[model samples]
Target: MNELLSTEEKRAVIELLYQLADDDFIISYRGSEWLGLAPHIEEDVAFSSISQDTMGHAAMYYQLLEELGEKDRDYLSHARKSNERKNAVLLELVNGEGHYLHEPRYDWAFTVVRHYYYSQAKKVKIESLKQSSYPPLAAAAVKISMELHYHLMHWTVWFTQLLNAGGEAKKRMLKAIAKVEAEFEDVLSLGPLSKEIVKAQLIEEESRLLLSFHANINAVFNDLSIPYKGEFTSLSGRGRFGEHTEDLSEALNTLGEVYHSDPGAVW
Candidate 1:
């Protein structure tokens, strides 16, 4: 399959794979920070499972790239420089202030909002990728959609209850929503290779995906009495374009320290 693609076509596929792989990799690390610190024990377990599943999804994408003659999955995922990642700027932000193992001031509302919003966006892309011209990607999308059903449901429960809970919960959710929206545009973007990606039918174009995304989310917002603005932007630099925040670099250091310490040791 790797040998079959034209130069531009293969580049587009590699870029798309990197974007998908990096998004899951970074966000899963963010999710892992919540371990044992969730609002309750049940949620603690659930969040960990979801993060594990997401990281597995990231591994699949990375494997696909490896088959395309890129580096091994571990090197692609654990050793790639932060600027080489193609994840959305939104997914890379720290989960609040302070260290997770120390006097962590992590915000539950922000965690809930970011994961829920990101899950929705991921679902939208996965649905389109089900029909991706690339057979392996489409197959992976089908397999991923199975797990996403439960992932979305888990987050949906939190997203709805917290937003409509009233008082501080509502206020916190709203603030989190605004902060997430500021960087959500980068999530929806397909990056500089989008034209070639779309041209090769790797997945639907970004506008089409964005339109479907809005429709899917607006229904929930309406039920909760929140007005739908549909406005999103990249306040941070675009991650898909090799631009990122120090947040990503910091995250890489923490998450990859084990692999870095002994690159030959198997996880």
Candidate 2:
């Protein structure tokens, strides 16, 4: 009985849902690349678990879109071109040089920093969405929030351990942090429908969410006796506005390999 939304409200909701679903979809793919390749077996399992949970969250959002009379969840998740996607620019970047199946030289420090920053931001967004004007979205947020506790903890543990380890670990982490933060503005963005999304109360304003994220991460940094400028730049184009790097195109090509071969068994 939650079908009292106007056309505009529904459009905004759909767009926001696409952003949510697309962000998780791309990053979970990135996370999956680390399978069997994490620093150790235990971490291999843990990271795999997190990636699975994240993909499930993405499915939930796409299913919500389906309920709103959109395309099938399969097509939504698998068939969209990169520019049609609404994910943040940061999530679409490759893991590192070389293919995973080949001589993969992935950067663990970058992985830790990227996931840590993303986890914190996701936590903030989900908490806000729990109060979303759209009931289905709010409920989805509630369910997703339960699992995010572990997600945040896992990434935070890695971030903290690397920073405290000092020397090379710390240096690499600092570099990763800078790289991740440089593109974080788009991650926090609500896409081209920001005002409309905020107008519909699908989530809180980006400014407020940004403050919460800064405070949360700054406190974590302070605990480690590290200085955080909390600064971000628009050095990259807005993925939300259908702008993206070739990295996303490459990712889509790999991800859609099976789907293109046979959409029926895209799993």
Candidate 3:
């Protein structure tokens, strides 16, 4: 029989899983809303695939949570309180000032940079999880890591193409990079439980993992002849500390509406 997680291990595992699940869930929700509004038809198709992958990753995380005795995956996902959510603010932010439905002047460059940076971070985390001592999670990580190939490739292409496109696209891309850099430390952080998770061997050391992340981004920028400045900006507050934006509240309202209506009602 497989070894079950100890009590402390279970708590640690749940913390990590909730972060993973909620981050993907909220981001994918926004991505889904953007389906028909993308700049180009071909790009829209490609973008939808990314949203689907994110949702799929969320589902995988939810399944793991279910095995750990959370409410049914759907209920836990859709009915959770705003404070209960563990996703970063960046993942929950709205696409733009206006609603996604009408007259929303979404910027393609921001989308590319945001998705590219986040996807790369997700890949790094998943890679670390593949070696997690928790058997079920490690197995799931292996499966999730497989699909990242397309995701990383797709975002890389977009990141490079638009950066090279020049003009407005380049301006937009640069702005997006600035926005992403502002909040990046949050993504790299594992929150207050970082030390515990590291001790549990649930993932690799944060510093080492972050180094790998920087190396990957540096390589990409170098290939593009973009000067690789090690500096990253963070105009926004630290999201890993549970601080959030109004966008997160709005997202929780929509995502949890159906689930909150009848969290106890069997679906």
Candidate 4:
């Protein structure tokens, strides 16, 4: 049987879980919105796998939250307010101009850079969570770590292929990297509760995890002969503290539209 946790411990665990869960949820939703819009059919299939994996990870975190006295997973996920969401704004941003169903001009370079940068950060966090004092979360971390190898490899391949493709591809990839760097700080922040979360051993210190991410991303850039600043920036506000852009509001509208129609209905 599981032992009872103090209120503080529970809150830390729950909040950390929310951050992780919301990050995956929003990124996967954006990925799903890509659907038939990927640059090539083979990549479409591969990218879908990453999206499904991310969503599956989000579902796992939601299940953990359900066990902690939160509302049912469906309600908690779909019924939350925009300000309540903990996802980074970069993840919430649309793939490109125009609607997903309309004449969308999606940029593969942006897609590759964003996924590559975010995946590296997530891998670092999951590694830290493997030692989480919250037993359930630590166990989930173990499972999450197992799946990240494939996710990292998939994105790494895309990142390198684009960088090495030369000509227009390289130019676009560099531009995408610049854009990702602009919004990257949101991914690294642990919010106002960072100290508490670290003290409770729910996850590692944000700085340490950030270092790991820097090394990982640096190696990728080195191999591609691309220049990388040792640090990341988030000219945009931090999402960890609930600072979000209008993109997130639009995302919530799309994700919750069906669920809100008949909120009281069993279906």
**What value does the lDDT take at residue 139 in candidate 4?**
90
TM-scores vs. true structure, each candidate: 0.98, 0.97, 0.93, 0.96
Using TM-score as the measure, the top candidate is: 1
Per-model CA lDDT versus the true structure: 0.94, 0.92, 0.81, 0.86
**Model 2 over residues 96-133: C-alpha lDDT tens digits?**
98787999999999999989999999999999999999
Q: Which segments of candidate 3 are over 4 A away from where they belong?
A: 1-3, 233-235, 264-267
Task: Indicate which candidate wins on lDDT.
Answer: 1
Q: How well is each residue in 1-267 modelled by candidate 1, as lDDT tens digits?
A: 777789999999999999999999999999999898999999999999999999999999999999999999999988999889999999999999889899888999989989999999999999999999999999999999999999999999999999888999999999999999988999999999999999999999999999999999999999999998989999998999989999999999998899999998877
Model 2 stretches with alpha carbons more than 4 Å out: 264-267
Sorting all predicted structures by lDDT, with the top scorer first, yields 1, 2, 4, 3
Alpha-carbon runs more than 4 Å astray in model 1 = 264-267
**Stretch of 10 with least lDDT, candidate 3:** 232-241
Mark the regions of model 4 whose C-alpha exceeds 4 Å error after superposition: 1-3
**Residue-level lDDT tens digits of model 4 in 1-267:** 134777877887788888889999999998998998888899889889889989999999999999998888888778988788787777888787887888988878898889989989988998888888888888988998888889989888888987898999999988888899899988878877888888888898988988899888888788877788965666666788788888888888888998899998887
Q: At residue 176, what lDDT does model 3 achieve?
A: 85
Model 4, residue pairs in steric clash: none
In terms of lDDT, model 1 sits at 0.94
The positional error of residue 49 in candidate 2, measured at the CA in angstroms, is: 0.1
Candidate 2 lDDT for residue 246: 92
